[model samples]
Target: MSVGDDIPDFPATGVETIAAAARWAGEHFATVPAVVDGDLRWTFREYIDRAESIAAGLVAIGVQNGDRVGIWAPNSADFAATVLGIQLAGAALVPLNTRFTVTETGDICARASVRAVFTVDGFLGRPYADEFAAHRQERPEILADGASIITFDGTGEDSIELLIARGTDEHRREVDARVASLRPEDTGIVLFTSGTTGRPKGIRLGHGQLLRAYWQWGGILGLEASDRVLLSNPFFHAFGLLVGLLAALVRGTTVYPLAVFNSADALRIIEAERITFYPAPPTVFQTMLQDPALESTDTSSLRIAVTGATSIPPSLIRAMHDVLGIERVFSPYGLTEATGVATLTRFGDSVETIAQTAGRPVPGVEVVILRPDESQADAGEIGEICVRGYNTLVSYLDDDTPLTDERGWMHTGDLGTFDEAGNLRVTGRLKDMFIVGGFNVYPAEVEAVLSSQPGVSAVAVVGIPDERLGEVGAAFIIPKTGASVDEAELVASAGERLANYKRPRRYFFVDAFPVNASGKVLKHELVASVTAAPAAG
Candidate 1:
């Protein structure tokens, strides 16, 4: 909970946020290595200059401030610059995960009113240019079934290569002028989240919210002129877009984006670049720690290794510190609405607590625990974590309605308990709850228990609609590396510890869980795939 000062004012706009950082870096650390996009490299000044070009290009394309520009691409310098460029043009960027199927991307694109799409011709050693174009060409219901398509390189059915190529250097300058007129409260992003409402809701964040989060921790995150921040996650995520990209400017830090994450290579880059700051997700940490190269590399330069996006296992936190030699493993709890970080744990807290708790609210942020009746809950009691803060988003896109109830509090669906020390510990998602034989069972509880199993690497608990119990608990498990477990034995052990009703009725072991760019388990995707499996496949 250690913090330095009051939350500062959000730099009126997102472009201003990055521009400020570029100005600082240009003066103080011009020679320092910044971005590492595949093999392409840049200094802090060079990175900002590239963004200026893209900003101008976006403006020439008829994009206006608050206009949505959807992007579907991997983690690369182009993707990073486009985020800043879109902001610079006074436009909001809607970043879509490249990992999603065409159907998923198509649905999101349609909802956001995306005027233009930016995507790679192909990636991950797979040809997907056609998939990107199918959103405009085919019926979504029919396209959900895998359809082979071609690239939009003027073929018009497959990709946006033409659209991007069409922008000239002159266009780039015009776009920059357009970007210069943006307002702080304008929609900066339309982040899609899979909520229980059946479809993903566009979680909107304005320029003010985006800039405020970066400024709140600018000085604290050591975003000083000479520092280098490592960004390895996909650009589609707020974690990657704002914290790693936009935060670079306001906080005065240079960025080094890893297009692909290889733990061995990550160690090499840390040593080679002498990177001082990094914000990694749980999956990224898991990958690096498992690599044997960590033992041989001198990764002592990194000042902090922040982890978030999902609940990090305690073992992962300990391994990052005791094994991988990371200086700190802090977890900050936030959603798309909060502009990224709303709660943060200090760097040196014990792993057990750091891994389990989401820590205290950031300065000037107020968090409340609400009962079912909407009254505030006492400390140590389980309740919804409601937040009210300056960093909070203005509203959802196309809808200016308030997210709070009649009482004026954002009812974050996350369930948590505040300890006597006033730290927030997120337990589970409320929409994921199910009534098993008249008893309510939360998937996180069962998943945590199963994750502790010797042969289990990861597990996801879900409730399948059933005729008898109304809903039945199901689990998809990933066995530990080079290990195996019997489904019957695993189910029996779980049944022994819990009331009979809460025990999982079926178990299926899979090689991996399907996740989005943010490392969040796509529960709906898992449930859909599992539900379609005939008797657990």
Candidate 2:
């Protein structure tokens, strides 16, 4: 059935609050498993019950309505519970990336005016609490006056265990009143963008926008109770928090979150839990496929695979089906501003179609390709992709950057085109496109061509300054294990596959590319690495 005809019926869910959604999910799917972290498992009822306790605890500690509360930890059961607790306490959630440093976290926390932060003492051998305190001391304004820091894992009285112990019947009653008082239009979350490019921007989004958007996602994806999802995406990002975790609440899917992605451990969980659905960046799948344990592990239980965060390679889609045993693979595209989903490939789309395009706009979102003059571009014409919908964020917190023009159309700053079927083909970022001798060179196009090469595992193309041409493409190649490529031959292949101006002038053979917390390639860092080297004529 076409997406237009098969939309699933969802609950009226009038409140639009995360707390309300959790209550609905718990009432309906109470006995079903909601989350499984390590050996700990929580039914939907248990999950909501814990969230209520946390909410009461937060309220007892003075977290008021609309106050910003930051959660700084990796993906875990605690992370999931705190997200609901913050909202249930009538505060806006601010999820800090686990990969962020003390200074970066402080910058965002200050900008968001976070009054309280829930974090860990350390994770993966780094002391976050100590580092954050030191940074806050240095920049006294980094935290709001009298802000409280609560640790998720510690022996101190301020730990999560002690806080929950402090929750009384009176506090719980206050929590109930707080949740009831929240309006659909209330600010629900403030997610800061990854600061790979510059200082991160805090995106303020309303509960209504987030809940409505994820409902569409759950409907379009055909998610249902009993579908076990392995979420490798970090909960800090919208993809993980909104789509991965919150979507589960909407659909009642059992979610297993990996704190940090480990291919071998992921394989073990897939085998042990009989995981049916998994979604992550293409690199995560690549790493899993390359792992030696995958040959011996049982992954046939996987039914659906969702990928995005970078361009999808046609070959990888084939591998996901043939090599990884996934039945249906989907590629979706969106940014933080759009509430994490705008376009999604249909369930039964042809592999080639899914590989070639990012898919049609999800219901409610209107996508248009417009030229620089704001004129609509014809089909298959390369232009900036714009979106308008209820999913578009309200605004960037603390920055005057306009999110939309008068007509509510958000210029995505991404260059793309629509096929005859209205599927989106994102070519590259407008800021990332460079001019080579008068010709426009899109790095994504060049990278796409090179990615099909036999020995290449992953590739990133960045435009570097040239003495002759204004800018030229530099290719960074991470070759497949036990495989080798001749640079001249690879360059010759690129020459045949692309136009002269789009071809790379230099190739850097590397083990890996520098990526942000979200697994997006840091092109600026690649450019810096290329510029530090001698010019390749």
Candidate 3:
């Protein structure tokens, strides 16, 4: 039987806002560990108390309902608290990626009209607060009137602890009143997608959409109260904030957030916390599997493994089960616009199915393939992937591009097809696809073919400008430790397996890939590298 048919239906929760979800979980799972970051720990009850105080503190600082609040820090207890507190204070949250430069962060904040920003003095030796202060000096009017910065781990009178201490009984009452007054359609978060063409676009999502979507995610994963989640994804991304933090909170699972993804540190945390479920991009697994500590680390506590964002080799799934003792491995498909997940492979799916396709649509979502003329494409036909569901983004903050048509179908710029069993195989992004001399070339297809070869740890394929062929494929490969790959052998194999037009003309062996905090390879950077090379054909 096909994999998607066996998914068991689950009920969605009535929790509307992040605040409500935190409160409900606190009441039901008060004694359960909520946030475990380094030496700091908080149970669900204690976490909610701090969130309530933060909400009151935001109210005391003149952050009113519908105001935009920015959180610019790495994953920590304070990040989670500020996220929930902002929700409780009836303000939309804007999470800036820590990897972004100060100029980039300033651009986003200005577009969102952020009033008060919550940040840290520094992380990983980078002075983030200092950078923001410098930006403020350059553009004094960048922030709104009376806007301020509240440091997370900084000394001064305006720190987060001071904000909490400033919360009065009256402000606390106002926090509850504001939460009660919040409607389900109120803006929850304004996430900036790494737009391919120009500046990032703020994707506004509502409280009900994010709450129910991730509650459904907990059910999809069959998360239990006994589950301890190890989260490596950055909270600034949808995968981290929605699936990692909110899902775990709503399901009564203990969550451990890693500020920086170090393979050795990840191993230590898994052993110490007895982490059962780990949801990350495939690069995290690739790195950990290659770590020298893998053989010595006590990884038997790992039970469930979820990976995506890149093509998953069938061997990787098998290795996760056999070597890491992780029995269940799943690959979900989504983007920033779809609330981080639209389709997910279930636990019991065949290894081949999980490796080849991103399983059926989530319970409440409708996924369809549309041709260039906007007509529905038949099964097995590649076209633009479109989605219509509760999890879809509310709107783009910059331009009303009419992302959704009259019928509410949001045409994702990704190209893919579905099998008869309703499993989706994402072929490539529309922008990532380029034409050879006279044929269409999809980079994902070529990369999938190369990923299975021996000694190839990770690979990325990009189309480079070619005078003869119009555009040709160039592959950048990272070899596994103690293993070396011959460029001639790889090109020969591609010649035998892939179509002539799809074969990569050149191969570059690299030690590592330039990935973002969320483990996503920065393809544009790779393309720039190719363009700068004098010998690139």
Candidate 4:
């Protein structure tokens, strides 16, 4: 099927949704706690006020509609307020991943033509202002008024609190007053694509796209007021930013946010906050569930858990429910392009379905599976996934090339098939599928087999370039329960399901994989890790 073959009229309600949440909170329990940080709580009313003041800060600094501002901080209440302030001020937002090095962060800022950057002096441990000063010095254009350093905890320059404190009540009113002028079609933010293989492109998103995805996913997943959502994931990415923060706002609920991910701290907060909901990258949840305090932590209060970022193992989904005592763990499949939720396994699906399938498409969106032969896959046949809808991103930022091309469909470079029940099971990135001596080897398929075996808790399969075979497979395993797992036993497990040519010639049983904040194992890092071994040479 071609890209342009989309059905029209997928209605979406976006921009005004936030106003509804604000009005609801303002009228009902305005003084009730809405955001809980480290010993800090902000009531719904207070949150609105803080957001207003921050917007005033932006306005005073000359930010306006269409202006791009960089939010370079960890997950914090200030980070939430800063984003809201950007929204209220009618400015486009660019959230800088806090894990990015000074050089990497500077490159994105320069590329995006970022106007202002709001960051902390030191967070968790890293000193921001000093490192950024050097990085910015290398490429000096993106700085805002020496680029206006607005710190969260007074560690960098003037505290984010002070930026608000200096603004008058009238200034704050002006900020909120400007919110009335925004539209659903206006570019809310340029969500950058993760640069795993190429330069990161900004995924252009409008108000309608984000809001519709939130409500649509919220309906399927059920986000409610009584649910105390614990958000420890980074707020810079869409998973943490929109799905975690914005979703909570739309649902009119309490969100306990953390500046950085600390497993111990998150568990402590979950217990103390009586957190009822959590949506994190699978890797984060898996590691958190493995914590020694898992049994003792009052996680019994947790009702629903949502996992995303990368494809989560079915084993992980089932383990969380049975072992951690969570009622359900939903897997929402999406990218920044779809806002966040495109297809998801909703509540009440069998544990097998919840773990194996990515679930059906959201009501308005259309998905098609087309093979290289230009034909549709009858259920159970794998093909490239193409999607089109109102919530879909229009194009890559700064470049008008429609992300989906003339055909109206964005080709997701993933291989998967639909079941009789219509649940989509993603196999692996199409590009990652390697050919070893004419034998096709899907890394994810091998990884699944490896991780399912006894004593193997985590597995990542990668292709290593070889002279004669063209490319060969490699497997990295993280042993179960912190035990010392043997390499021979693991290799033999794979040899059962996989052909001799498809099996890995080399293996790595490590303490952990080099993962990003979102929990994706940097497969490229695995390449480096494997090649560095003395045996490989």
Candidate 4, pairs of clashing residues: 3-407, 3-408, 3-409, 4-407, 4-408, 144-147
Q: What TM-score fits each model?
A: 0.83, 0.96, 0.95, 0.91
Q: Model 2 misses residue 149 by how many Å?
A: 1.4
Predicted candidate 2 versus true structure: per-residue lDDT over 139-236, tens digit per residue: 98988887878898888976998889888999999888888888877889988777666777788888888888887787777777978999889888
**CA lDDT of 392 in candidate 2?**
78
lDDT tens digits, residues 436-465, model 4?
Answer: 998877786677777766566778888988
lDDT score, candidate 4: 0.74
Please give, for residues 184-279, the per-residue lDDT of candidate 1 as tens digits.
Answer: 666777777644445667877776666667777664454566777788866787777777777776655667777677777778888998887778
Q: Which model is ahead, 3 or 4, in terms of lDDT? A: 3
- Least well predicted 10-residue stretch by lDDT in candidate 3: 2-11
Model 2 misplaced regions, further than 4 Å: 398-402, 535-537
Candidate 3 pairs with clashing backbones = none
CA shift at 149, candidate 3, in angstroms?
0.7
Q: How high is the CA lDDT of each candidate model?
A: 0.69, 0.85, 0.85, 0.74
For model 3, residues 1-537, the per-residue Cα lDDT tens digits are 333434443233655787777788878889989889888899989988989999889999899899999999989888988899999999999999998888888888888989899999989889898899899889766588788789999889768999998899999999889888888778889988865555778888888888778777787787888899988888998888888888898889988989888999999999988999998877789889989999899999999878884467888888888889998788889878877768888878888778878988987888999999999999999899999988774787745565688889987889998998888999898988989998988888899889888889889998888999999998999998899888878888898899999999888888877776445677888888888984753
Better model by lDDT: candidate 2 vs candidate 4: 2
The best candidate by TM-score is 2
Candidate rank order under lDDT? 2, 3, 4, 1
